[model samples]
Target chain A: MAKDTMIEELLDAWEETYKKGQLTFWVFLALKESNKCMEEIKEFVERASDGTMTCEEQSLYRNLRKFQNLDIVAYDSRKVSKGPDRKYYYLTTTGEELFKRFVERNIMIFTKESIINLLTQ
Target chain B: MRVFTQRLGQFAISALIFTVAFRYALDLSVGMKSFPAALVCSIVYFGLMFFAGWYYGSKDAVENEIHDIGFRFHFITYVLCIALGYASYFIGWNTEPLRSLNIGAMSWGIGLALHFVFFLFAQKNAIRGYVKEEIFQ
Candidate 1:
């Protein structure tokens, strides 16, 4: 039981370190899939990351603004029936290319059979 | 609403500080003919400006939708400082042209030029948005 607790603690620490850098990747991935409103983007990130990652709406808005400034993302304001206009965001061409290069260089390697087998073992 | 008022109050305070310090520094160096004392005043002016910028600029970056706050703040502040420098000279607050310009305007103009270059490169990356019609058509 102590060994299990020890392992759990170690995994928790590892995730804490790893998760900090992963939000940007997850945010980009969510936008890449489809143009989504703020709430939708948050849902996508939480659902896709299997609840391991969560983000506040304020943080997401800040990130979106930064990405917009960098030309990595853009949005269109669509009118909603109930209230004010809602901004639906999507990855820009630059962002898509950036994500492609990032995945090819970093994430694709983990998909190799050798790496996959080693991870499973 | 609360945040907006807080930001407005901060802006008001910053403006007041700049106006008072800028005038005092100009008067000290130009009117008093105390170059060394003016230099100290100028340093204080710069320190206050830089602290206000770096502190609030970083916060503004994440909190506000505006991304070019740093560049804009530096540009506007320096421009106003230089204009005030020239105005002081024209108004006979300073009898010396070179000393007046050298004390504040010229130095800040150079800094503004460098900042402009940074803004150019940073703004260059800002491309056109994703237009649905363009893609569909």
Candidate 2:
């Protein structure tokens, strides 16, 4: 029974790891270069993806919040002239390192080698 | 529950495929006997799985950054253990067959436990990094 519990625990952990939408490399890439708010990230994604990719504000905000929870993303609200303050998101050092590794095998925005260099700094 | 079950099934199927390819690679490399070969194989295998998880896991609308962080945490811990094993072997401290298994196991357990708690509690906090102290302004 103890062994079974351990196994179950392992599965639960894996489930947590395997949860969907946890690897939005494009979103990370957008923020890695500079801190950005939701609109900025969305615009960057669209521009970078050339209209092929778009992340809705709601999804984007939720992703940013989750990343913040992991300490991979950091944010500070900025006041604008016309509206409510917006949260600008950027990759924390930890997030940048993780992004570098994630870029090692996958090509999301830049060449693998170039991205590793850019993200490492 | 349906979503969880569906996710479990998806993960199982993908994991099965990855295992098949990974097994073939190992068989071709060192026949699973040599320690270094096994070690390298495990690293590459897990690394590939990590990428695969990230790739597929990002499909849904809801994001789970904590989950991604957990994956990286375990992967890094595993890599560190492997590096330590290699370093110890080269330094003549021990053989290449993971002489200090307890170190790896203990370190990984500790790191993973800490990672679990950090992410879990981080989600519980009502506030995030953003603040308005008016000092910066």
Candidate 3:
């Protein structure tokens, strides 16, 4: 029991450190899939991350706003069936290019044969 | 623009509160009881200042995360406090306005200058990689 607890604590610390700024990546991936409202984006992120990541609506909103300011995201006001107009957000061309380069440089390396073999082993 | 307007509205409300409180406190403290009244006024003013700063800081944190409301709030506080302090003296409400204003203004001015420097440094760091127009565009 004590060994299990120790391992769990170490994993938690490792995950915390590893996951920093990863929300940005997941959020971009969601937007890259399609133009989505905030709710849709939130759902997509949670589902796509295989339940490994969860984010508060408030933090998501803040990230979206920052992305908008950075010209990494843009939104269209769509008239929803209920209530006020909802903003459907999507990546701008700049954002798409940025994400592409980021993935190519940072994410795609893990898919290398050597890395995959090492991981599987 | 909308965010700026929202912040301006919040600032205006705080300024109005300060003006009213300062005037009322000064009026309450007449000749013989002036010292105690001034003391009460100072307490009230500082308290309101603290409340306004915290209240609006939190509101801005929630609503205006992109903008640096810290520097803006402190800058406004310095300006308003100095203006009010001197205005009271000119209007014959405060007799020793210079003495009253000196300590607070000097300390806060130094703090505000530091805040401004920090703001500039943060701005530089934010734009280090990207062109300003590109980011905005």
Winning candidate number (TM-score): 3
TM-score of chain B of each: 0.59, 0.44, 0.71
Candidates ranked, most accurate by TM-score first: 3, 1, 2
Q: Which stretches of candidate 3 lie over 4 Å from their true place?
A: A1-9, B1-8, B27-33, B66-69, B85-111, B122-137
lDDT tens digits, residue span A25-102, model 1: 898899888999999999999999999899999878877876785678899999999999999999999989988999
TM (chain A) per model: 0.93, 0.67, 0.96
Residue-level lDDT for A76 in candidate 3: 97
Q: Write the per-residue lDDT of candidate 3 for residues B30-119, one digit (tens) a residue.
A: 554678878887788778878877877787666655345367677776787677777776777734557767887788789899998887
lDDT of 3 by residue, A4-28 (tens): 9999999999999787778888999
Instruction: List model 2 lDDT by residue over A88-111, tens digit each.
Output: 888999989988987775545665
Q: Model 1: per-residue lDDT, tens digit, B39-60?
A: 7877787788777766766665
| Candidates by lDDT, descending order | 3, 1, 2
Global fold similarity of model 2 (TM-score)? 0.36
- lDDT for model 2, please: 0.61
Query: Which model scores highest in lDDT?
Result: 3
